[model samples]
Target chain A: MEEVLRRQIEKIVTLTDEEFRFVLTHFTARTVKKHQYVVQAGDPAPNDHFVVKGLLKSFYTDDLGKTHILQFAMEDWWISDPQAYHNKVNATLHIDCLEDTQLFFISIDNREKLCVELQKMEYFFMKKTTAGYIALQRRILSLMSQKAEERFNQFIQLYPTLLQRVPKALIASYLGISRETLSRMSAH
Target chain B: MEEVLRRQIEKIVTLTDEEFRFVLTHFTARTVKKHQYVVQAGDPAPNDHFVVKGLLKSFYTDDLGKTHILQFAMEDWWISDPQAYHNKVNATLHIDCLEDTQLFFISIDNREKLCVELQKMEYFFMKKTTAGYIALQRRILSLMSQKAEERFNQFIQLYPTLLQRVPKALIASYLGISRETLSRMSAH
Candidate 1:
């Protein structure tokens, strides 16, 4: 589990064993079963989870009871209600395990302290956040410009692994297409 | 113009006069007229612009010649082809001035150097990127769940200044609604 996080950090910045150990102290580990909720709407989202194993998804349920998948986090990915966590507000999104999951979770306070104590971690986080910002911009463009078939093709190209793991109906929800439309596209 | 950049940075982290001057040295200023292109598709997007005056928009033109507005940058906002800028790839978006504009622009290399030299800047950027990520998530949820009228109302409430300045047709395109639909809703 620690290896997963160390590898992720090493991808951007090199850290000595002592530095890596210090970083690890700021996080806590957790194991959750499938169907367990890590974050739920109306509760404070105090920690950001870094996935070590298995799958989890964050989503919002609309007034009509329609669920829209915001994101899916697998190994080496991070997931959280970023707004709630950063702003210290009640979560507007729910995050639950799709498979029995192992994660390292860090509260905002600890994360900030780590960044302050280790300048490298601040650079590491900035790079991650910038990459995430770029990805969300790309997703917005895809949502605005792509037709359902095009979006499905793009999704498959981007996350072929996810296609195998996630339910097709949930994938349809993430793409904002009807399940019928997804089925038609998948058939083609 | 330098004061604008300094003020923005100071909002997140206070800086002494010497430090602010050091930060300013990394950026260059430019003036662009209405309809002028700051970034164009297929060109390398090497710089991110910070708006000092006037408005600009970034958009993608689809294969079918339909244009989709990805973002709008007014005074004090930042605009760039984030993917292209960060990944060192050719731009997939075009950014053009909606009105005569003044901007302070920084290349990715200079920006990185600044962050490395000043830890506070790195923190400022991480906060800004996280805020951008959260805003994009909110937009995705709104797009998935809201009706045209609800989106329009949300847009008005969030960016009343933009509604007064931007063309209604462009606003309709941004909201993924037809111009006719926007007209009908605005009338009511």
Candidate 2:
């Protein structure tokens, strides 16, 4: 588990062995069953879960009761509602395990304390957030510019492995398209 | 100017007088004329500009010639095209000065070099980028959930001083509304 996470962190910032060990001690491992909700909308977000194994998705239900998937986290990814997690407010989204999952949970309090000790860890998070923001901005622009089929093709291209793992219906919802539309498009 | 910047830096991470001076040497002060483009679409972005005075905007023009205003920066704010600035790629967005402006420019290369000297400076930037990402996520959610009037009102509430300084057309574009609609709403 430390090996996988260490590799992920190395991509963002290099840490000394001592610093990595200090950072690792704070995270608590938690196992979640498939389809289990780790967090739900309106509940307080306790931690930013780092995926060690399996898959998770964070989503929100709109006024019409339509589930809009905001993010999908596979191995080595971090999943949380950033605003809710930072502020410790009632979450406006839900995170659920799509497969039986192993995760490292780091709470906001722990994150703040960790940043105090290991400043380089902050760099790891900042790089992740910046990368996420850039991707989101491009995703929004694509949603505005591209057709549904084109968006789906792009999504498949970007996360080909995850595409086979997640259901098409959920993927369609995430893409802001009807499941029927997704089926029709996939058939072509 | 240094005093104000010091306070801003302290909001993220504390810097000693000597450390702050070290950072100051790396930044070049620039003055932008009104209506001048600081970073244009298709040009590689050179630096992240920190506003000392005046206003600037970053926007994207789509194939249909509709401009999507992504962000507006005022005094004490940092502005850049994230993808272009971070990846050193040709920008898909343009940044223009709304008024005659004074700014401190820091190249990405210089910033990385400085981080080796002052790790705390890196922590400062990390927090700033995280805050920016969180704010941008909220803005995107507002675009998804709120009506034009609500977004306009929220924009006004957040940047009352900027509302007075920037033109109606840019504000309309920022709110994703027609200029006529913004005029009507403002009149009412």
The candidate that achieves the highest TM-score relative to the unseen native structure:
1
**Residue range A1-188, candidate 2, lDDT tens digits:** 88888888899789889888988888888999999998888989979999999999988776767667888999988999887888778899889999999989999889878876787777677678779878887776665555789889999899999889999988987787788999998888
Consecutive 10-residue window with the lowest summed lDDT within model 1 chain A: A130-139
Scored on chain A only, each candidate's TM-score is 0.98, 0.96
* Candidate 1: tens digits of C-alpha lDDT, residues B132-170: 899998998998889889999999999999999999999
TM per candidate: 0.98, 0.89
Worst 10 residues of 2 chain B by lDDT: B137-146
Model 2 fnat value:
0.31
lDDT of every predicted structure (CA atoms): 0.94, 0.85
- Best candidate, DockQ-wise? 1
Task: Name the lDDT of candidate 2.
Answer: 0.85
Q: Please provide, for model 2 over B11-37, each residue's C-alpha lDDT reduced to its tens digit, 9 standing for 90 to 100.
A: 878888888899998888899998999
- In model 2, what lDDT does residue A131 have? 90
Q: Who wins the lDDT comparison?
A: 1
For model 1 chain B, the run of ten residues with the poorest summed lDDT: B119-128
Q: What's candidate 1's DockQ score? A: 0.86
